[model samples]
Target chain A: MRFFINRDRFVHDVQNVTKAVSSRTTIPILTGIKIVADHSGITLTGSDSDISIETFIPKEEEGSEIVRIEEKGSIVLQARFFAEIVKKLPGQDIEIIVQDQFATTIRSGSSVFNLNGLDPEEYPRLPQVKEDLLFRLPQDMLKNLIRQTVFAVSTQETRPVLTGVNLETEEDELNCTATDSHRLAMRKATIERNNESLSFNNVVIPGKSLNELSKILDDSSERVDIVVTENQVLFKMKNILFFSRLLEGKYPVTKGMIPTQSKTAFKLKAKPFLHTLERALLLSREGKNNVINLKTLEGGQIEITSISPEVGKVTEHIDSIDFEGEDMRISFNGKNVIDALKVVDSEEIHITFTGAMSPFVIRPTDHDHYLHLFSPVRTY
Target chain B: MRFFINRDRFVHDVQNVTKAVSSRTTIPILTGIKIVADHSGITLTGSDSDISIETFIPKEEEGSEIVRIEEKGSIVLQARFFAEIVKKLPGQDIEIIVQDQFATTIRSGSSVFNLNGLDPEEYPRLPQVKEDLLFRLPQDMLKNLIRQTVFAVSTQETRPVLTGVNLETEEDELNCTATDSHRLAMRKATIERNNESLSFNNVVIPGKSLNELSKILDDSSERVDIVVTENQVLFKMKNILFFSRLLEGKYPVTKGMIPTQSKTAFKLKAKPFLHTLERALLLSREGKNNVINLKTLEGGQIEITSISPEVGKVTEHIDSIDFEGEDMRISFNGKNVIDALKVVDSEEIHITFTGAMSPFVIRPTDHDHYLHLFSPVRTY
Candidate 1:
């Protein structure tokens, strides 16, 4: 590729595509980033089999020249070292020239780097997805959904499907659920799309890819176009294309894991509840599984206690601002409560318990768009 | 101990001492912080065998009462958890009451924590150092000297003494030197001491402990008292006492390793040279030793080159702003140069090379107080 491009713009685009650059050299070509310059623009692609990210820098942006391409060609350079060099190069404009032999020269300011470039033909092409089954959603909403549920996805690769977040659509409502068999987090939001009454029952996108894409998405208000095929999913936004390979197997039906009814429910301030749970977590560290007991007393108060035979017991009484139903006691992993409390933006949160052995649900006092369910530990 | 102390003051003191607290709980009691309350004030001490830090919270400060002691006693509480709890606790003043049954009640704001406390008698006693061999130095100057040389110390504990920085004093000059055998860094400053000319030969203080102490010493302008005993070194400042156990054995005579004469010398802008070295390091990663080659061209320019058989070669040229002695070329560990340059505050640095195989010295153009030496690696 022979092009003169704005260093900052090129650097920004390179960083976005680098999110999918493979660190493992198992597939040597995948460790390099493919760069192509044509009449349209300069395109950069990075992929690691599981996910691929491509960013395009147009010849001109906002009436300003961003890139001037002299020759149409392609070359692949080592992703990590190239990115580091480009970032540290002291210049405002960078000139990249590729010779017939695939030798690349990057000159900026007073520094010029001659790097060995690989034949881009050796690099694997990104899978193309049909636009027929496309949908649109606000980048911020999608990012929020990913943040709220992705943490609950199983990190272990033993069950590959569990490591992906399940995304299902019924009519206009999109439900995102992630569970590790222990705790489940689900977020539901409505999106405006051209497709009518569409449903994706068991579509599972790898949680790791979604997390990486979240960081790449800069403008939250911009609507991103998502196209889904049988095995590949593509997110296109503002000259950047993110493609992720979907999990093959069907995702487990986590809907059955969440309770539809509750036996006892109480409203507690999110910040205070989080602080009290943190204190209990200190004591819980001495226990086998960092378990803390939550007891709702006769009055509007919750007593969080953790005990260890050798490290004594700690009890923290937090007054409940609001309460309903019957008083009850339950024990759970203190870390679970801490995780659930972090995403809760509401001043007060309502926690409901179905029974001693059943999963409990925590939701914001005013909204139903997000819900967190925790499987209570059976403490003997 | 029964006392109501200013929470902020107490927490600050506790945090300083807790820096020396051992993370490994092999000796369970060692992980706990010892607190002793007297009629004068409360003293908190944390130790990890090799290093101990003691911080004293006086009963009064700036004509204001900081601690109101109700009784005199002592107890040991878990350092890590206690520091976290105290930092997070919501209160201006914390009430500490030690019961006859060895139960400690720490009340702050609306929260009350009843912790199981151990007898302080079980805690290790602080090492007593005679004040006769005391010296005084500006805290900031001492910290700067430590920072300049500590990073060059050997990290591997194979020869335990090499992990400590050697401090020697002659006349009014206090010299500190550290080396990993491959490279050495030395810093010297003039200081006032009670002894006319005392030499602390082979006195090695652990690099890890000095690093931690450097972070704790925030007020560099304050005077620091240095007390040396047979096996311990104490740095006493206002309300804080940092004690480090000296590493046994003779430190290698690094003075002999430094070349007294040089065959070639050059003056270069420190920042630009650092940037050039970083660029050369990128290509060096492909080699077995990650070595970069430096060559002095016919013109007033230096060429830095690195080549990998499989991954291409990189050549970067930096114009020499100034040159002296003879035209020469040398190669060394790029990482060592980068590390040494990070501590150099001067704009211009003078590099003196004895020969291709011998160690080279880098120092500020006009300063004699600081010097950094790096051993060159054979590129062939």
Candidate 2:
């Protein structure tokens, strides 16, 4: 490949693709980015068996030339060091040439870097996916969905299917759910579907892959097309393509985890509730089990307390906006409660408890569709 | 100790003194900060054997009350946890009381933290300095002096004396030097001396102590009193008494290592030279030796090159602003060169080379009181 591309544009593209390129890839060629240039544009591809990313830089966009092509060829350069060199090279435009035996020369200003390029044929090809089942959603909405639910996915690989976020469409709405057996987070929204009768279900994408994809994606109003296949899925937007493998086996039935009715429900400001738990957790974290207790006082006040014989105790009072039903005390993992509360954007969050022994649920006062459930720790 | 102090004022003092409190301290009480309240003011002290920091807060300052003493007593509370609690407490003023049997209660807003405080008599007392030799200098100047010389101190504890910066006074001039045998940095400044005949020349303050002190001190024109004794140095500033233990052995003589004359001297813009070395080092760092070669071309052009058999090679060209004396080639550890250039504040830095085999020196074109020297690597 012989071309001169804009340094900034090239650096931006390389960073996006490098997220899928892992240094610990069992396939050696997967560690390098596959670079192929034709008369139209250049395509850069990176894969680590779990996820694959391919981005295209056209020769010209909106009558402004981004890359000027001289010869059509292909080569693979070491992704990490080459990316660093190109990013730090001091110039506006960078020239790249592939000579015989796969030797690549990158020149910018008075600096020239010669990097070893692996054979392009050695890199694996990205899996092909059909457009049989496709859906389009705003980039910002998809990123929000990933952020709200991915943190709840199980990091332990005891059950491999629980490590992925379950994304599926039913009727006209799309729902995403993730659970680590202790807590569950679910978010749902309506999306545009290519086929009206398409009812895709049980397509679990690795939470780690969704996190990386979210990080590389830009938060804009632009719509991105997602194509689902039997074993692989592809996300297409602008000139970029992101592919991720689907987890094997069926996801657990998490729809039964969230309760429809509550025994006791109370509304508390999100900020005040988060801070009280944070101070209480400081003492709980010092103890063996990260547990804190919440008690409702005679007045419309809640007492948050954590005790550790070795390192003192702490108690914080949070005035509840409203409280009803039976007054009871509950113990919970303070970290799990804080994590659930942090994502609620509303000023007030409504928490519901079922008989003090069953799992409790927290939902933003203004949001009706999203649900967060936590299993309380039983204190003897 | 019972007092109500301004939250911001107390947090600042705790942070400053906690630098000397090490979590790995052998003395159990040293892991805590000692708080003593008197009729005049309150004092907070922390120590870890090598250094001790004591900061006092008066009852009133500049028409603003900083602390109000309710009783006179002393207690030692865990430094790290107490600092965190005081910093994050939600209140304008914090109330602290040391109850009977050394139980301490801290109250702020609606949050209360009960901590286990140790007996103050168990805490080690800071060393008393006689102040036979004392000098005064602006805080900014002292911080600058430490920054210039501390980076060159030996991190390896093989030779304990090399780990400290050699500081001495002669003829009203204070000079500080630090070297790791491979490179040496020296800075000198004239300060106001209380005893005109005082010439203490054998004090070697640990580089680690100077670094922490520099971090705590603000950049201002206020003068700081430096008290020098037989085995301790006290940096006395506004309401702060910082004490550091002196090294036990004699320091190596580094004054004779800097050459007075050179065979070739050249001046180049600091920014341009630094960028060239940075790009060259990217390749050098990948190589096993981390050595970069610089050669002066026939027509005032300088070229930097580094070669690795497996990773290819790179060459950078820097158009010299000025060159004189001789055409030569020199190889050096690129990291050392970068470290020396980073501290140069001037637009242009002058580099002097004795020969291809000998050491070289670098100094800013506008400053003559500071000098940096680096030994060349012998490449076969």
Candidate 3:
């Protein structure tokens, strides 16, 4: 089995697949990347059990030859070293020859590297998901939804399902939610789909896998086809395919956690509120729960204060152009407020509170597409 | 105490001094930066026992007022948090007011921060080194001398003094050497000194401190004054005073490790050889010593090879344009060779070897300012 491929094209595809390469050598063969060459093109696959990434370099691109398959075959080589060698190769084009004995030789300008290759048959095959349940969405919208909610996901392994973002689809609307109990973030968007009223409630995809996928799909205007199955999900774009195994278990009903009514709400500029929260966090670090008290004073003003027995106290007053409600005082983790404020892009934000102890909701003053909620701490 | 200072100028000085701030809280006060405001200006100091950096912000610079001191006093605040706040402050000028109780109020554009401050008298004072034993050198040359040899210093604390670079001055020549037993790097430069035939030998400065000093002295053309004492060394540049404690005990004699005679010598381009060593290092990761073999063939060519039982083998030939002496072979740590090559700025390099088992020398083809010696590993 042998193949001669253009170095630049091969390197590009190798990098894409290398993102999913297993750093842990638990499964010896998984640490290597599988390379298969045939009449059509060369495919590189890297997997770490939870996520698998495959990139294909065609025989020709835009009427230019990219590869020449002398003999159709497949082999697995160490991903780490192979990628490094390909990137550092000194030539514009590279020649790869795989002998019948499974010895792979890679040669470029003035440099040649021979790597011991393993039988590709030893590598696990990628699970095939039927495209019947596929839905297409703009990559930009999907990336935004992931970034907005993924950071709120529980990173701990105690409740494994909480470590994944829950995606629910109803008719033409897509809802994504992530929560770690202390704080929760959700984003909603519209996508074109033929399956009317289809609901994928509690379909949890690991937050880490989503982040990696987002980094690989940097181009915004491109459309990505997502295929969902009972146990695995696939995202297809250009010549790359990304597959991630779905977390097994039911996601908690977060709908009940978000308050349906508010006793008080105030509209404040997002930047000013974020800066106030940051200042409070600085002072809160010396306190027990990193807690800061927020008081809605008369005449559209909010006072943020924190006090440490040994470090003294700090007080900051931020004025709100519009405020209406009974004056209220509440204490909450300053970091939670800062995190929630970061996801709100609007200049003005409306924050609603249902008593001091209940979870409060914060959203853009004019947009219903994103919502952030934080549970206030009892400072008594 | 009260003072109004230019925010940008204050932030710059804080950043420079914060480099010496201790991350560990073993001595709580060491994590705090001491700020003293006088009628002249404000001085900020940060120290972590091993090194101390002090930066002074003058009341005026180039006929423009940078600081307006209302009252003279001093206080120590947490270095990490203070620096962060100063950087994020919203105004061009910051107003600082200190109360009799030591509660400091820092105000900027619509934002006020009150931090608990400590009495500056508790902070350790800088060591006094007599200015008589001082010499001047170009900052760029000093930085160059440090970078060329500091990497070879022994990191292990087994021999405490070996962890520092030894600087010796004789007549107008300044010589520096560092070694980790297996390899050695030495650099020498001509400088003007007060004493015509001064011999300042065995002056060991900590490797870690030199690294920080190198980063702070970014200007190559500026002149820096060096003051040496029995226990401390000071580098004065402009308004900054950098102090480092000297390493106790005698440094090892590295002169015998460098061989003056050689049986084989050859000249090669620095870039090509460096790239070849990098490729060999990539293949050597599977071996215990990360060893790469180099053999001088009959023709003016050198063969580089690395083999691993499980990772196969790689062999490449590098043609030498100029060569002389007996044909020989040697093996050394690929990492050491790559590091040595990085410091060399010349296009052509000269390598001399006494024997396969003896230490070899590498230097620029036309310069005598720097020399790198590496001991060959027994490949057989």
Top candidate (TM-score):
2
Count of clashing residue pairs in every prediction = 1, 0, 0
Regions of candidate 2 where Cα sits further than 4 Å from its true position: none
lDDT of each: 0.85, 0.89, 0.88
lDDT of 1 by residue, A24-76 (tens): 75898998999999998999999998999989898998899999999899999
Ranking by DockQ: 2, 3, 1
lDDT of 3 by residue, B310-341 (tens): 88777788888668789999999989889899
Shares of reference contacts reproduced by the candidates, in order, are 0.40, 0.69, 0.54
Q: Report, to 2 decimal places, the DockQ of model 1.
A: 0.51
**Relative to the unseen true structure, what is the C-alpha lDDT of residue B346 in candidate 3, on a scale of 0 to 100?**
91
- lDDT by residue (B335-377, candidate 2, tens digit) is 8888878887789888889999999999888878788999999
Query: Residue B370 CA error for candidate 1 (Å)?
Result: 0.9
Write candidate 1's Cα lDDT for B1-380 as tens digits: 69999998888888888999878857778989999899899999999988888888889999999999998999898898789878877779998888976788888875677888887778878887888878888888888888899999998989989999998887788889999988889999988788775557778899998999898876558889898777889998988889999999998877777788988777788998888777777777667576877787766687877776665666777776566567777778888888899888899998888888888999998788999999899766
Residue A162 CA displacement from its true place in model 3, Å: 1.3
| All candidates: DockQ | 0.51, 0.75, 0.58
Q: Model 1 chain B: which ten-residue window has the lowest total lDDT?
A: B306-315
Fnat, model 2, is 0.69
Best DockQ among the predictions, by candidate number: 2
TM-score for chain A, prediction 2: 0.98
